[model samples]
Target: MTEFTEPEAKLEALLGIINSSARQAIAEYKKTGHGVPSADATTFHPLDLATDTLALKKATRLLEGAYHQLSAILAPPQHTVMNFVFNYNWACTNVALRAHIADVLEQHPEGLSVDRIADAVGLDESKTARILRALSLMGCFKEVKRDVFANTRLSLILKSANNTGCYAHYHSRDVSKYAGVLYETMIDEEFSRSHEVDKAPRVFACRKEGMEESFWEMMKNDDERRDIFHRGLIGHSEMMGTSSVLHQYNWGDVSSVVDVGSGIGAFSMPLAKMFPHLRITNHDLPEVMVQARNAWEENVPEALLDGRVEFVPINFFEDIPVAGKDVYYLRHIIHNWPDAEATTILHNIRKAMGPNSVVLIPSSSTHSKNLAVAPEPMLPNFGAGSHRVYQIDLTMWFLLNSKERTLDEFKTIAAAAGLALTQVYDLVETMVIEFRIAQN
Candidate 1:
């Protein structure tokens, strides 16, 4: 019965949303019997490591969106604008990831002095302390005592072996560089009006530095960078909680699945494990296929032995995937290219589809009003709650001249590929959009 038309009423509504969503998140944590995580906690909570975090994520989306909206409204205009312009947390996080600060702190549960920490990581003492202190403000690392620091739950994510850490590393170091030239690329004649992959801000930035290999070509040539990129992808899955689709979707109905553009089988490997009955095929370029084979051999050799999984090397732009699978799942693939290339990829997959086959694209559908929207008094796209969705869209724009699409945009591309949007599974940060052949 409450109308949220006025600014005061809306603020009250957001506060209520914040309170309710926080309680929901706490309840999810308590459901695990491990209680909620403390701000200063050094270790991960049990739920933190669990595979299905959809409930927690849902609550968190609202909680994040509401509080951030409340803050923007209450804070001074200059302060809010400056916060956007002056944020350099990415640079600080990059330093932490590259320097292995969390790995160093892991050995010191009681915390370590800045001097010892710097010496261990070979960073200058005073400057390193500044970085740690900056990150500590956001609860990443904790200043346990004067001039000493210890890892908190957030900081533990930056440890070298963590998948999500790998993702953060790549984003912070590489993507940030591309992002820096956004304005220049927008105004440049050759790049400004083109949607070609080579016209991306990344190409512009790289050209400035006299490095000229395309992103994929560069990845193909560098073994270490390629390895890190693939691992970072798994971390990307973890960060976006894309793998939660395993539990949310009805895999029981899917007997076989072709993982289109599958990098190292991040989604398929777990899918195969969870539903042993699924005949999973990974489709990627030859080099990625080799890596995917090794990953499968090392991680889930049993699935291979049982004849449940296969690796099919493909240049998805040109190659049609294996014919007639129940599901052709493209996770985080389409967003890497512009509309024309994306349409071609989907159309190629369309060629391999059987009458009943469905192409599942789990992607960041940026600001799709058809999907989740905030109630009145809050930004419709949930503002900061949907922060990653918008950022990833920009990331695509920067790196490849591509972008995350709206639901209508998705349908347009799907229609061009002779497919129609059939279903959408809203999985918090991203959604799994199901497409099938268009009817006459």
Candidate 2:
């Protein structure tokens, strides 16, 4: 063993003393629920591990407090590293990886060596190894050995040609088109300001010359892309849909239900299936309604499609044609606009709602303080304390100038629209804010 110098030996001795003191404190706390003074009280007053257990407890609490404080200081760097790892390559790298994995696995269902996969996908062997390593860390693939890789459950999903998996439009160039704009928005203030109105000018401008499309608009244009977008929304809905007031809602009293801005009828179709007696009308833009109608006809039962569910094409901002529905369900819609615009949308629905009708707005809650009930501590402590929701809030800010709101904010918006907040249901991260027309 290498011998230590005098300074090093002295430092080691100090650390040993500290460790002994801590251990003694812990033992005292364990034994008597308090800490006792050690025999060497003059030079090294080790904690009393016998009777003074509270001292040990206090030290443990202090250590926890210091750890959290240090974590708070280091959080920015940690977040930066994570963002660099995930957000780097503008999602193109992942798309390319998915495509290459799928192409290779299609030929060799048994499994292909790393070199063979690289050759099949037209990638350099070393570069492929690096990419595969990254993907393996992300749980997208399994590493059989040092450089060899095999398809995982996630990889298989990407390899499938059918619409079943989340990979249908994973490689869409259109999806990656907004990456540059998003990147610029992160670094440059001027570009960030411009992105507030025109999210993807290159793509959105080409599609419709001068018109600006919200982030969702570009994603919902085509079948494959719409499927991918809806899959993501379904994931989000599943997470937030738990708070849905539909269970507490009296579906028996309602004859018809209108789901406004119902994209591909994820919310409406399920309601129709749940309540066979209630007729559900899915109202959306003409393009979306076309897809919704096709999806409903193909996926829903023939009997339900015949009369129970109808796809109506209407610009909700202009006018709502169908009226007297007992329940008007709006999920993940109101949070997409500022208060004034959200109120306008709500007012239009109110115009179509009867006196006794209940309008349900299922939105993610922005209440950060209430997150004390969360089992684990939420990250960033940004307004709502949820990193996912906060990221979405920023995405909304840059894309549509909309915002996710707190419960009080929702209530205020309802009041502005001459609606009363009847009940608020908390569903995990999502909230169902039920409203009725206020009596004069």
Please report the candidate that would top TM-score against the real structure: 1
lDDT of 1 by residue, 1-440 (tens): 34666888888999999999999999999999889999979999998877798999888989999999999899999999999978889999999999999999999988999999999999999999999999999999999888999999999999999988988898999999999999999899999999999999999999999999999999999987888889998888787888889899999998999999899988998898899999989999899999999989998999999999988888888888999999999988888878888899999999999999999999885667657776766777788888888898888899999988888988998999999999999888888999999997
lDDT of 2 by residue, 1-440 (tens): 33446654634443453455467546654455334433212111232111112334333433333344334444697774675566534243455445557557656544568898888777788887777777667655657677777765545445434332342344334434443355554555544444344433343324445545556566655566676665545445443333244465667787888889888877776666667888888888787888777777777766254687887888877886489888888877887766776888888998898888888887655554443232112122322224455555654554454567877888798888889888875544455778899877
- State residue 249's C-alpha deviation in candidate 2, in Å: 5.1
User: Cα miss at 32, model 2 (Å)?
Assistant: 44
Candidate RMSDs in Å, in order, are 1.4, 14.2
Score every model by TM-score. Answer: 0.97, 0.67
For model 1, how big is the CA root-mean-square deviation?
A: 1.4
- Which residue ranges in model 2 land beyond 4 Å of their true spot? 1-93, 96-110, 116-125, 154-227, 238-254, 303-306, 368-372, 375-385
Q: Tell me model 1's lDDT, rounded to 2 decimals.
A: 0.90
- In model 2, the worst 10-residue window by lDDT is 42-51
